[model samples]
Target: MFLDRDGTMIDEVGYLDRREDVRWFPWTIDAVRLLNRAGYLVCVVTNQGGIGLGLFDEPFVHGLHAWLDATLHESGAVVDGWFLCPHHPRAVAAEMRGPCACRKPGRGMIDAACARWDIDLTRSWVVGDRDIDVMMAVAVGARGILVRTGHGERDLRKVDLSLPAGTPVVMDLMEATVLILAEGERRT
Candidate 1:
């Protein structure tokens, strides 16, 4: 599974830099556990433009992810991998500046994860609260699910017609997981 970090797994706090700011949404751990049990790899694909914009740094993002991993470990859940893009078109730092393929709406991060992990994109699912998440999935033949959390409700209003037809939209990750598991059973 390809999941979005902010909004999907964790509550959207806009540029979460501090560990204390990390807040897991209700049922997040349980939902992830469900995916883990269902044999999903649970890879996180996030676009952290705050790093490029100078709101935070890469170390802050890594530290926050580390904290999240430890917290999930306490619950016996595991995140197989984390893929982040810290670049923006108008970044302050030269290295972080310029449009990048790794950013969402681009397939760089997803492609990297697939190559590194040998993921089967056709059998994968992308869960997130943004249109870009759906776009990413569509680009790589993965199913896309939009959850109405974080910026989801707002993003829903702005979702263009580019998304694949019949893309599932759920209340949150927990509900999305249920749907995914059920669909998997039906397919088998």
Candidate 2:
């Protein structure tokens, strides 16, 4: 499964730059563990425009991901890969940032992950706390689940109200894990 990091895995503090700012939700570790045991390659796809904006650099982002990996490892869950886009269209760093397909609401990172990991996008899932996450899932032909953690509830307010048939909204990551596993079983 593809997961968005900022709001889905940890608390949203608006442009997280420091490793000290990583704060995971209560059941997130368990939910990841569940996904791991279910044979899902849990991956993180995040937009780090702060890096492109000169607030931080790629090394700092990598360090934070390493720290997050350590934290999840301690809880017996291992993230398979991390794909981040550090570009924003407009700003002081806009000159430094160019348009890449990896940005959210786009399927660049998702497509790359599928190519690298041999993922079956049609059967995979994406979970995040934003409508853009849902859009990304649709873009990749994967299922989307918006969890009510971090900015989830706030992001939900921004959804287009009208959905195109199938979409999933769960209370949190734990419930999402349950739903994905159940659906996997049904598909099997």
Candidate 3:
């Protein structure tokens, strides 16, 4: 499964550059564990535009992800991979100073994950709280579920009409997990 990091899995903290600023939702670990136990290669694909804007660097993001994994490991929940797009159209950082395909709504991160793991897009799913997150899945024929946490509610007001009719909009990660698991069962 593909998950969005900020907002979708954890609290939306504007630009999380420090580990101390991390605030996970109550059910985040449990939901991730559920997916992990169910044989899903859970990957967190995020758009960390802060790196491009000089708010933070890539090392900080990696370290923070490592810290998160260690914390999540306590509950037997682990993210298989952490992928991010650290680019923006107007980036201050030279390296990040251009739009990249890795950004959400783009397929670079998804492609990177597939290259590293034996992922089948047709059977994959993306759970996030934004329209771009859902569209990420749609780009590859994977299922997209929008969770009503973080920016989900506000962004819900202007979802792309091009998305499939009745694209799932759930309460949170747990709800999305339940729906995904049920769908998996149905498929089998």
Model 3 regions lying over 4 Å from their true place: 159-162
| Model 3 lDDT tens row, 1-188 | 99998898899988887788788999999999999989999999999999888889889999899989999999899899999999977897666866678988998999999999989999999998888888899998898999989998888787454556789999999999999999999999
Models, CA RMSD each: 1.2, 1.6, 1.3
Task: List the pairs of residues colliding in candidate 1.
Answer: none
Which lDDT tens digits does candidate 2 get at residues 73-102? 998998999999888776476565777798
Please, what is the TM-score per model? 0.96, 0.93, 0.96
lDDT of 3 at 188: 96
Q: Which ten residues in a row have the lowest lDDT in candidate 3?
A: 156-165
Report how far residue 78 has shifted in candidate 1, in Å: 0.5
Tell me how far the alpha carbon of residue 38 in candidate 3 is from the true structure, in angstroms, after superposition: 1.0
